[model samples]
Target: MRDDNASPDEPGTSTDRSGLSRRSFLTAAAALGLLPAGGRAFAEDKLLTFEKPRAFSFDLLADQARRMAMQPYIETKSRDPKVLDQIDFDAHWKIKYRPEATLEVADGSAPVRLFHLGRYFQLPVGIHVVDGDKSRELRYDPVVFEMPEDSPARKLPKDIGYAGLRVMAPDQKTDWLAFLGAAYFRSAGELNQYGLSARALAIDVAMPTPEEFPRFTDYYLERSTTPGHELVITCLIDSPRMTGVFRMDVGKHGPVVMDIDSRFFARDKIDRVGLAPLTSMFWFSETDRPDRIDWRPEVHDSDGLALWTGSNERIWRPLNNPPMVRTSSFADRGPKGFGLLQRDRSFANYQDDGVFYEKRPTVWIEPKGDWGAGEVQLVEIPTDDEIHDNIVVYWVSEKPVGRGDEIPLSYRLTWSKDEPHPAEVSTVTATRIGRGGIPGQPRPKGVMKFAIDFDGGYVAKLDRDAKGVEAVVNASRGELSNIECYSVKIGTAWRMTFDIKADDPEPVDLRAYLKSGDQTLTETWLYQFLPEPDSAA
Candidate 1:
């Protein structure tokens, strides 16, 4: 590791660091009594105001959460909701955190910044700076933020606290990591584009009962002493049903990786609890591109859910823009890993350039220890527009959670262009559904055609003339026919075509794979097809 005490003029010290290494700089500052022990850091830095130092640690935070669960839960409220209501999306974006106020923490590294509260995000979240075991809370003041004279944010009180915080790139331009909304946080992964968000915890999600959103009410940030890890974040979450703590060690590699240690305590029994939940938008892709809804060829942050099972099997389940709410669960003993991936990288596929959907990062979750028996649950809610987040995936324990339950889990989140695991078998590249019968022929009623593409594994090297390539197919409610698989010829990709004859109102579970003799050549492609009315079957 580089010397933390190195001077700005030091040969190896980068200019962007501004001579301040977050860990050492803050440590040295606190030693000098930068501000009165309890008052604020504002005297030293106008952007920050701090409270007195308090002893803190990961275990302490978890213990506090457990204690909080034993007591009654209280909901967080805004100091002035009426004023915040005037600051809508347009007004919020107009308020910017001044560059001079950037918080320090990177390899000596990235600068950290604060976010302002607004209409959509009104609940104040306490932000703190941690130096060793002592942490100081940063008080909110309008001096750190800039806005126009007429901006409604100016009417907000000084102690409104921050809505969230983000870590900026060395260039002081783009933010690589951000914590915002409820328990939501996201990383601008390999491509440096923001997309999906991961939650600290999900309670009773996608159930008949209203989903509970646990708020990350407080944050403790410290510059990591570890070589690659840049920032350490501790979040205290509170909800009506539970209280929890999430400790994250965040770092940037080829992918942005967050090693998270989560502890949740329940005050009452939860019908369902989702761990490591990922949220994103999946309006429409090639599989079911509804006309008039969007002019873009495809629109979605992620198109498929990829899973690595404990049995050493791989499965690729394409996402769908269902007509109704859909929840699918894949059971497992100990899941190896899973993620929502945007495999289609071509810019032409997305068309519109404002927010590059093609560049949206893929987030994979790898359990650090045995997760035991659980299932990867995917809940896709119907959406007619791209504005709403409609896709959610998380791990749900087979064991039930009840009152006074304290659950601990650890996992690593990799935000990247692709999953961290090496691909040894061909993966589903594309999935398209359309009218069943052969093109130019009379379309068969109650029959839908399914075409899937696979590339980049054993199938790529297989002989084009190999007749042994069998398109093994199965469906829960329909007969599959016209099955065929062949090399596409342009790339290593191969295509599988088939038809499913299903008229049932329920979704049809279809599974398909390719193999030559005893060896499986591709990951299992599972599709939950929601049937449509058809005159012919």
Candidate 2:
């Protein structure tokens, strides 16, 4: 789940991590000329001072992680839990970082700011600045921030450390990226909205046993030579069962692009370890909407999971808000790529100007090298609203990892409005579900109807009236009938409608694709069907 400064009562609410309100802060900064056009130049008044340098490298960090894993894992406790409790949501908002204290790095390439420790984030992290092969630790100081006179944070120790850190624009007001709460981080993509989050690693997620969240104990921020272009960040992750090192090269061209290199060492055997895991919210969508659930037409950070297999087959699976926890796995060898995509880009589809669901970025995971045999796992947890993130997707290797095993992995993450590598075949545009039965006939108790839309690529060139175009569909445990396919009036898009007669209450797995003669013209569409509560009983 993506952690923000929101209170428990305001779960999933978007918060500005720059320690200030979004609109007022940006407007004021711009008016003062602190933020120039294109958001590239910074004021000369703020500069970062460096302490004595110490030698550092990636190998040294890996060695440190290995040594840490050899010893017993000790959990880091909060120094002042009572003080953090007093600095709750309301008080935390009142505390802000001093503008003059902003750390200007790489000669105004990107400004840096710190997040104060609060109830949601009790464990502090060590932060440092890197220059070439040398680095210096940045100590915590209460004078760097401005808090209300009555704020509980003022009473805390001067060296309490920071909860997290954020990378801001040259203005030091609008932040484009942040790392906070566990090994989790997110970026405001090309559209500048925070939705889904990417975690460093996930251990035993959705298993019978409790899940484990690792912590980023330390961070090293490197100075970039190119102004307003890129930044390098290295993190040391620690947990009870594992220790790891991560290096990320983040570029802010338009859509945020991150190249990640990670290595892990395990203290104990882990059967279920998720690499490059993504977490998002999926409360409701057009496919299955309860009566007047909310005012919005759809509410979700991402609508579908797209996969490109090694054999060159494309697949699209629409997301769901299931009644129970559900796990789906797609096995592959040397897979090309996969990601959770926000395919729907129309504002009318969401009708949410505040959150702008239509602008949520689609994050794609591209492997840097051959990732041997593994399966892409998708876990859907039951959620009544958008507050709780209910969707998680990750890649799990088939080979088991045991204690003392050293695992190295590398991948590139693209946070954009669309998939970086799109399929040449047709694509699934939308999915809709409703009651199954003839319009005038009595409705069937144990039946359902589905309408799937396919557009673009070869399908757009072929005439729908012409023969040979077929809807290849099948169900795992149901009778499929009354199939129909036609072109919609708006564009060259084709719609396929079908009904399923599910005599039993068991869940059904359905797959469909567009084919012309022996050639496949569209990517495969997969969906899961769960019977209504009354019918299931």
Candidate 3:
């Protein structure tokens, strides 16, 4: 993982790239104020310098991406890696942008701040401000940044360039959104706590071959003219395998929302192209509490993947921390939307009050146009600690992508405490796993119990002692037993508990839902159970 200098004292964590750790991403700009007390205005010295203006447009950027795809890829290199490498976490934080030097777009509609290049982010990304049909590149100079007396960043060259950028709040102490290493970006959503990261695109993810991380090489920031929209961010992303242009219309009304338009040009055949990908952390929740060694009862940014299929079926798949890397694909056509949700907002679930996991935002992906024939893919990588981001979910179109292909996908991402649209059917509240057989009897070996809860919608109004409730269940490779459905003694929610004897060493895919006679009472619950030898069954 690669992230540099993101302080642990910060509110949210960022997923690391090659040189950075997962916790190093967001802390740089999430809550820290760049300026020291009473830092004077640098406007008198023309702090925000710029190069000559050049005509720019999303269409032009997309066309350029297509042309770039036709030619061999040229990678960007750091001007002085040795010096940058010395700018580690502490030193990098010392070099902060001066508040007075912040760039104001369209007469201060949005304020933009620059990030200094550091060890993890050695290669510089161009920063530009767009006005009308023309855009001007911001000049990088030591004058804009405040460095300590002996900061390592002082050794860098004058034109070493910027690493990334963030959109600042009016207070300037905290940032609402930030674009950092690789193609990753994160927004401090309605809760003002950063948890997950969203990427422009993902290539060859979870494949046998190593994954490729494309970089956003340049950015064009502009003020949004729309009433609700605050900023317009356009970027040019490049890699050996693909090139693309993404335009994001971002607004911070309650929940942070970004309306994104991505145009990609494939330079080579892609086995899997993940569109609108979201990267998160799911270490151990109530579902895997028995496997956890940490003191916290639960720890995760998201607990489940909520999907609305093209066939009008709503599914809730609880996230798992598998024994190995697990990739689950749900096939559909003209899909509606999908998102990773953090339903449990109770602070007691995660006792570590430092990071406030309870306030982490749930990000939902909403497709703009018809995304025909695709699979919502969830790739979970095993992690023992919360420092690593191990969960990634995205929409991958079934259509094979080859060189010389031009594709355009548009979607909106909403980061909040709940989904943009709540489920019409009762939604899953919690999932727990433990011993399979009865408590007083000898527990069956190779068997595991699954306890799932669902509340709201049609199920909420039903009687707690309803006699005809049924659990529609299915297992890919297991003998299911102890199937039962009843009302919980705690809340208005209904509970569905069952046990499956999965002898196979491989994972068992299971599905169940609460139903009354012929009518479905809750959204379908899907899970993958990994068997553990010599454990309670």
Candidate 4:
């Protein structure tokens, strides 16, 4: 989830492109109009000397993926493992792409730059430019990149392909869209700061078995005729158990918008297939920090998972770095929308001016059509540091996908600072946990206290001593006591305080919402209470 180069201190291998040139070149050229005929034949002959443009279409790519899925999955091997190993983190940083070689598409709205192959990203992906019906593969060349003369990249062969690519702004300095490393891609969002990532497909994530990472083998980029329209990108995804064809219409006006249409074919039985899967980092937040390790108040790319269920209920579930991997599923018939959002936008909350965690983008997913019966699942993995992306959220259909089954999915991904459709009712602002007992009395042993804050909506209109306003609180398995709700002095936000008493050591699931008479005044707040570790043991 940390950009494509976020591998923990190890090296890997790249994918091979041995069977790329097997298709008929002359037939494809004739159909695509790449070669000139009659009078113009001699004029364009020099342009086609190196690589010939071939006829390409989305249907052709889908057919290729279908044919590949029928055959056994073959893992692409690295062409030069030793050379890639030498290009470690330090060496990789020094290898920069030349500015003059940027692929200027869409009337120069955003230029495309290739990412150099390195230790973290060893697999080489094919890059092509589609003009009209004809497409030409951008052959790998060393001259396009600048590196130190003593750099190990010089020792690699001339045919060493690129690892990934990024779309830079019109200025060609800052990158807004990037696609790199195992079907992973991210945008800077409206705030123009990269935070979380969205993967093409997720297989057996957070499961007992080792996770399978599918890689994008090839990419064909086409520019739009309209000046400000979206860029069209077609990609081929391959893995040991599946193959897919994805088409992304990507554009960045205020926020980055990606309209994705993909067809997936499973080669093996998958326990879970996460669609529109998002990956982020959440080390600690103000809600519950058992260990006050970091100096910053919070460290997270995304703070909570916001959901708009099929039943029209809006829910907010604060993310947690639990003691063990936890998977929470919310069943729905057809989900309206869901996303991992960084709601807290204040800079003072994070206090870190370097990375600007507060400016991180909120990624929202809006399903295009009826997804049928499915559940929005969130997987939280334990992490002590911010380097590892331990949080993942996605939609899993109730119906399972088996071998040879082709599933078509479509959705729109909005990378922005706020959720696409925010709840009309008051939302949970903050969640604080502490000792259970009163301040004057000795703290209760097997109890925990919670203080939740709600602001805006109808709750903000009420006075300090408003009548009929109530806090609806519940726990899965615990005694809830000492519940109080009142408006804070400094702001119009209402604070709800409560304590949960439990004798068991198992974690407790808690939910709370604000209500006035018979009307729900706020979105539901959910939290998982982890039992305090015994010091006497």
Task: Evaluate all candidate structures by whole-model CA lDDT and list the values in order.
Answer: 0.77, 0.77, 0.79, 0.77
The list of candidate 4 runs beyond 4 A from truth reads: 1-50, 225-228, 535-537
TM-score of each: 0.90, 0.91, 0.93, 0.90
Least well predicted 10-residue stretch by lDDT in candidate 2: 24-33
RMSD of each: 8.7, 5.5, 3.6, 7.3
Local accuracy of candidate 4 as per-residue lDDT tens digits, 239-351: 99899999988888998888889999989788899888998878898988757598899989899999998989989999998887888898998899999999899999999
lDDT of 3 by residue, 350-402 (tens): 88767778887899998888999989999988888777788889888889999
Pairs that clash in candidate 3: 1-17, 1-20, 2-16, 2-17, 2-19, 2-20, 3-20, 3-21, 16-22, 436-537
Q: lDDT for model 4, please.
A: 0.77
Task: List ranges where model 1 is wrong by over 4 Å.
Answer: 1-43, 106-108, 439-441, 535-537
User: Which scores greater on lDDT, model 1 or model 2?
Assistant: 2
The model with the greatest TM-score is 3
lDDT of 1 by residue, 424-530 (tens): 99999899988888878887778888999998899989877777888999898777889999999787888999998876667899999988899999999999988
In model 4, which residue pairs have backbone atoms overlapping below 3 Å? Answer: 14-122
Q: Model 4: what TM-score?
A: 0.90
Model 1, CA-based lDDT: 0.77
